[model samples]
Target: MSAVSRLWRRAPLWRLCVYGTVFFAGLAAFYPAAYLIRAIPSLGKLHPGALHGGTAPDASKPGPGPGGNGGPPGPGDGRISFLPLTQGLTRAVPFGGHVLPLPAGVWHPVLSAQTGPNGAMLTDVYVRTDRGVVSGMVVAMGTAQPIPDPNLLSVDSPCHDDRAYARGELPSGENVVSCWAIGATPVHDAPGTLNPVVAQAVDRLNALGYPIPPLFMTMRWMHLTTVPKKGVGLEQADVMLSPAAPGTIRLPVPIDQWDRGAIAGAPAAAHFVDRMRVWAQEWAPILERGHAGTLDPTTIPDSLTMDPAAPAVH
Candidate 1:
């Protein structure tokens, strides 16, 4: 038995346990793609004002955010999801208060939040207020209702009454509100379009005397981006919607640039929020039939024409 005990009895214990189980399964598949895959990275590219949560598979965006609202269910009624407004989303989005008066901590969203109808988030928040670089509508509407903005105007909160659940003031002095329950721009709303226990049709303003338990964010509209006197160049920004300037459908959504192939300026502001959802469905019933007083200016109706080559403001 002297020949190394007969070569340990011809050693090959199951071929050395199959070459040590194929060398620890080849270091457990190349030691994590060769050294823990470059310290794990890759999810940092969502800033077209970034904000993506749900309901966007392609509803009607032929060219923005690569398509979401994800088509295939329109009159059947059912299914709605949308997101893209941040502050860590928890059901209250009133950036820099007074719906963005800046100054305390500044604000956000200069562009990108078009997800509309029922879930309607809308966007364009900027503020350096005291009347300088003002841009509003950091809106969110799971339907707090109150669009009867027949030229809103009625203020006091100056900067942020916690985003004043009702501040109002447009005809261009700017100042805005009507925000609430915004934590990803919510809204599954329909049954009465929203308001106390589902009450309905409200541009309602006996000085905005309703809503006590937060039926959840009304978030009407607010638009104004004029900055000239030789200072225009945010691609020439100049949009002015929401019964502004002596009213009559304050047109001016000239945008001209920033499509960068979509996803950020949201196809350059969804060609003006598809004309503000065709003015909240055909000018919110003629702006709630002139919201109780002085709003006679109406006329840009080629389906609220935002000029797809100019022709529809019939």
Candidate 2:
């Protein structure tokens, strides 16, 4: 007989099935109720009126990184000179920890937030807003789980996922889409040829047992769009950067045949789209940080949002 069966036989048989039912029912009640609780609106709760986490910077600071300008400083007069998005955030809450294109408006300060590591070696920063709690992740191709929509334009990112569980949805019906940010392309997932020599070198590396580098090294944020369904999707969409040189900013790859400058006015657009070339050189250290696993999300900028002088992204 199985070890579990033997132990059961030796133990008391009182209410065996009843005990099992009670144990399972308790868990059943707990899980579904938790998910359902999210749908309800709570009044008078503290809101995260500001942007939190390293993935997103304070709108006022206009510096760089996930939290500031990803390029050189702006003019001395305080304009910051970076892309608008990188300059500051529009501000808001968490609808499942996702970041959307900052809409035009004033964003309030964040009352509080919580951050932590997530599946696939990614970092998750949860921000509370007037609407609700939203999640923002610093994604890495090695561990990100993205949801892909067939209705949207597709790219060559290797780490994109089509599963429903991969997406973060809001009660208002908006969905977040993700990809290689604005300045990157997947090395192997590109549909057509990437120069002949580079392709050959990538093949050789795989043969020697090294995986092609993932796009997450440089790009990560999700694209915000209004979806028809209560659910939407995320894809590791890409743009062409790196014109065979280091730190050389190139124009974005057009999603359709059109004039080139659609994204020219976007905040930090140039730096974001071109970040991959610089990141590829720093890949080794990036990998080390991901594996180290000591990220703290609690410090994701609640203090920054509280300052009225702080530049707000909204």
lDDT of 1 at 309: 17
Give candidate 1 regions above 4 Å deviation: 1-186, 189-217, 226-314
lDDT scores of the candidates, listed in order: 0.24, 0.26
lDDT at 230, model 2: 33
Q: Give the TM-score of candidate 1.
A: 0.18
What CA root-mean-square deviation does each model show from the true structure?
23.0, 22.7
**lDDT per residue (tens digit) for residues 86-127 in model 1:** 332211123211221111122333222222333222222221
In angstroms, give how far residue 37 of model 2 lies from its true place. Answer: 21
TM-score of each: 0.18, 0.21
For candidate 1, give the lDDT.
0.24
